[model samples]
Target: MTTSPNAPMTSPTRRDITAETGLPYVPPGTIPAPASAYDGLPRDTAVAGDRGWDRDSELSQMSKAVIATVFGLALLIAAFAVIGRLGGWAADYGTILVYLAFFLWMSIAGRVFWWGADTLIAEIRKKSNTGDCR
Candidate 1:
């Protein structure tokens, strides 16, 4: 069988309104037929990053973050203690230096915590919303 090049293309459509998108529904196996390239096999898995849920990538990202945070906090604590001791060695500067160091440490640490919390919340929201309408 051969279709003339000038013949109009047509397919049977469904009656559904698709309440959400409000677009005319296309019957399954009709419009936009699947291609052999994207039949969801090993070939498709090669584009793993696009899928956004690979375990190894996520593990590496999380581990890097955890290690960096631990290292940073360790440095911060050591600096704080060293500065505190130096401040104590000076009689008149002790209270003032302690207060300044405390403020500085808390301010920077608090902002980092806030940003991490916000990112965590956003990631949680994104994870929870993975293609789920509700």
Candidate 2:
């Protein structure tokens, strides 16, 4: 019943599936099952093993921390800039300067910290011949 984008398309009928599988087609709605199958089950067994740090979490602790810090700094700087403008000493150049000084510094610091820490740790692990990343 599946076709590639360039393939000639044909509407799939139950006959098509039955022909492919050589078994009678039982439509999904016809299946009898409880509404909450495996309800209350833990998603996965609680197990720990050598799932390495180099390949585990979607984002490492350092990465999440760095992103959060940069985002927070950006928010704080923008808020302060707006407040400054509202306080009657508004200069476009001043706001820009504040942004450059604070946000730019924070962003650079975050990138540097994440990169430096990760590289340093990786290098250390490489020297020690302990990290199995390939």
Candidate 3:
């Protein structure tokens, strides 16, 4: 059979395709079957009843930021100690340079830590709301 070129094309139904191809047919936009009843649950349910800190909470995020900042400070101190031992720069400049460096480090680190915490909290909120934490 022939059809006119101007005719509108029609999509075949699942039954039509299955009959023609002798294979199981899945309609377009059909969602796949879930593996288990739990598969449909929200991702946050894993920690729903827990008494511990919520991983996505602002307090938890801020604690993480504090820990990270402390770790950075430790590294900065270690680096300064190593430099002092190798070049004696600290001895020449005394505590003044150390204070200045510490002030600068705290200022920059504070900003970075807050920014990181804010970003992480926002992402967690977005994922939670969208049910796409995974």
Candidate 4:
């Protein structure tokens, strides 16, 4: 049999391809299935629920955490300044520098803690909502 130049090819469409491959067929403007669909998957990071903090609430909490961190840093700086006025050579410059470094470490640690807690709680909430939490 001869094929016409204008004839549509017999090759399978994308839906057919996915069906044969056991993969999902994603339509345009639709979110694809998350990685958690395969095996014993990790939780999705995008979902937030009423059990913990919602997205906006999480952002607000993070903002507050950052503010508290900065406040703690400012207190350290003030303490160093007061120690400098007390005529301690170690506190005059070196202590301030060291405290600055320590403040950075503390801020980073706090951020990590807050982020981990938020993620954990959010995942728990998501699982609960989806009826996956046991």
Off by over 4 Å in 4: 1-93
TM-score of model number 1: 0.34
Clashes of each: 0, 0, 0, 0
* lDDT per model vs. reference: 0.61, 0.61, 0.67, 0.62
Best by lDDT: 3
What lDDT score goes with residue 9 in model 4? 77
Number of the candidate with higher TM-score, 1 or 3: 1
lDDT of 1 by residue, 66-133 (tens): 55456556656766677646555556667676677667876776555555555555655776889643
On TM-score, the leading prediction is 1
Report how far off residue 73 is in candidate 3 (Å). 7.9
lDDT score, candidate 1, position 114:
52
- Minimal lDDT window, size 10, model 2: 45-54
Q: Against the hidden reference, what TM-scores do the models get?
A: 0.34, 0.27, 0.33, 0.32
Q: Candidate 3 lDDT (Cα, whole model)?
A: 0.67
RMSD of 2: 16.0
lDDT of 4 at 86: 44
Tens-digit lDDT string for candidate 3 (1-134): 99999999999888888899999976657977658645666756774455554556657654665576566666566656655353355566776786677667666766665666566677679879999977
Query: What is the Cα root-mean-square deviation between model 1 and the actual structure?
Result: 20.8
Return the TM-score for candidate 2, rounded to 2 decimals.
0.27
lDDT of 1: 0.61
